[model samples]
Target: MPSADPSTQPLKSAEELAQSRRRFPGESPQYRAARNALLKEEIELRRHIERVAAQRRALPPGGEIPEDYRFESESGPATLSQMFGEHDTLVTYNWMFGPKRQRSCPMCTSFLSALDGEMADILQRVAFAVIARSPVERLTAFKRERGWRHLRLYSSGGNTFNRDYADEDPDSGDNAGFNVFVRSNGIVRHFWGDEMGPETADPGQDPRGAPDAMPLWTVLDMTPGGRGTDWYPKLEYGAQSKTGT
Candidate 1:
């Protein structure tokens, strides 16, 4: 169903809506007050997210792609237009698995691990793929090892797709990114992309984009300890790791 237009509908105060929720058992009045205030803020945050999405959707057509970037997929060479499949919209994640890296970045792998689970549901609406600098075989090898059954892994090693869309740098190597493209009226064009980077990061925070795509941090944020400053995902967690998988 389509979202109701805010301009056409009357709004409810977040405080009122928060209070409407059922209270937990054995919670103190002080706890309830703080919880209610937090809930109100969450509601506001949700509204802001929707507003931003609406603005994104309303944006004028983005620039046309410079070329039909070539990529190596499991079935062999495929063009950017072919990546869309039957859907008009295509979403791609820039995986940080360059040929030079011994192993893929744990952070990118972590996000892909989470994305793999939802690929089926997401593909039902739009085409999705993971683009990396590593060779297609290397990407598939890692996919098999990780048991990622749904992700469509591709290699941009032969083309400038990574350099153009994934922010590949000569000195810094592959950087993780998310890009959306659209096929319209026989023309493929660039759409929205997560432009947030280290330069955009706020003080004392990781350079994470708004509406964070990773469920790991989303779940962690609700905990008392939260996502700590030093803790990060590893390629392989040892048996002695404190956190449970």
Candidate 2:
């Protein structure tokens, strides 16, 4: 049996598809027209996201890591290769819970809170871990407090893993980072890391990358206010945190 060529197939009209789905009662013609127009853009946005993902998948092999970074896990010491478990690919989030910080970055915590829910599903495919400069005990204690059972927390306090990959500046301190690595033929290599920062930021906009990673921001962006400038995630919504962890 021969399969149809997707590229050669005729495409459906976004406008028609958007309008055909559903219509609300008492919607005015002006509202419907505007809604339909926005829907078409949304369709294009989805297509663009696919294209970007495809491009990322097609990237050539990145530079090999200089050394096998060490980490302290709840179970004890682990190497970068050991972190991959049975999978060749590993996705790590560098948490901003350093020895100097009073508490973990609220923004990082929010992202992890959402990611924790999907950790099981994520691990079913690629290995996922949360790395922090804080001691393993400190990291695990916070994990227990947050009730995050699925996340694999490891301490990078004994190594330069954070300095190399997590944007750990000697003076400015640490910033949350997301990085991917791959192990091939018994060698580990850097795959990619989030590079968007203040230098790349657009005017009047916060420094963030496309297809925003945080669900909190994504959901807010869909609202009428569209992720207001003044607000941000907090460790405790209404309460003040102590000076140190």
Candidate 3:
């Protein structure tokens, strides 16, 4: 056979690359075959995720923030730059808990709940924070209720940070946004953000960002019964009483 140029050679199909032979006991041959087919699709999904991530990283520097917006932290007032701490990159989640609202958005709360657990691990690489439009006291109270200890919570009240960042609805004040900022050579600039909204949602699906950020949905997707349309996370679930009490 004539030697083929590596660059010109056609890439192997995902199905062709799936070579798993191990089988679980009691699994039918039909089941194994179906699983192998699904595995091939999963491999392609992983590759697509990597490709999109690379494109994100290669993006040109985003718009420079003109002002050092002020925010209320547990310690006191802090600037956007101050939020970065020792890291050049900062990830801030704009939670939908405006002062006027009695409760925060359940969806935002759900996302934050998962993030709370990973705060320590995520902070090791970059600065992370959860910002809300409510007053610091109110935000802290809810934080306590949620049992989130690691997430650095902040209040964007008394500032235009939320409005400037598109994290707050100008008229309604309800918001849920995830934004990233980067400081390079003493200049701060917007890095990325989750711009997807209800308008962008596909037919019969809720609007969600690519590479879903929450594990709840991801785990549910793996099961035979996928994330149900009617089910959603709640702030409080019904308590289970002690047996025989």
Best by lDDT: 1
Residue pairs that clash (backbone atoms under 3 angstroms), model 3: none
What shift in Å separates residue 29 of candidate 1 from its native position after superposition?
A: 0.8
* Candidate 3: segments with Cα more than 4 A from true spot: 1-13, 240-245
Query: Which sections of candidate 1 miss by over 4 Å?
Result: 1-7, 240-245
lDDT score of model 3?
A: 0.86
Alpha-carbon shift of residue 202 in model 3 (angstroms): 0.6
Per-residue accuracy of model 3 over 3-52 as CA lDDT, tens digit each: 88974777788988876878898999899899899889998998799879
lDDT of 2 by residue, 130-233 (tens): 99888899999999988897999999888888889977873577777789999999999999898998889999998887889989889888999998887667
Q: What is each predicted model's overall lDDT from 0 to 1?
A: 0.89, 0.87, 0.86
Superior candidate under TM-score, 1 versus 2: 1
Which stretch of 10 consecutive residues in model 2 shows the poorest summed lDDT? 236-245
Q: What C-alpha lDDT does candidate 2 achieve relative to the native structure?
A: 0.87
Tell me the lDDT of model 1 at 64.
100
Report residue 164 deviation for candidate 2 (angstroms). 1.4
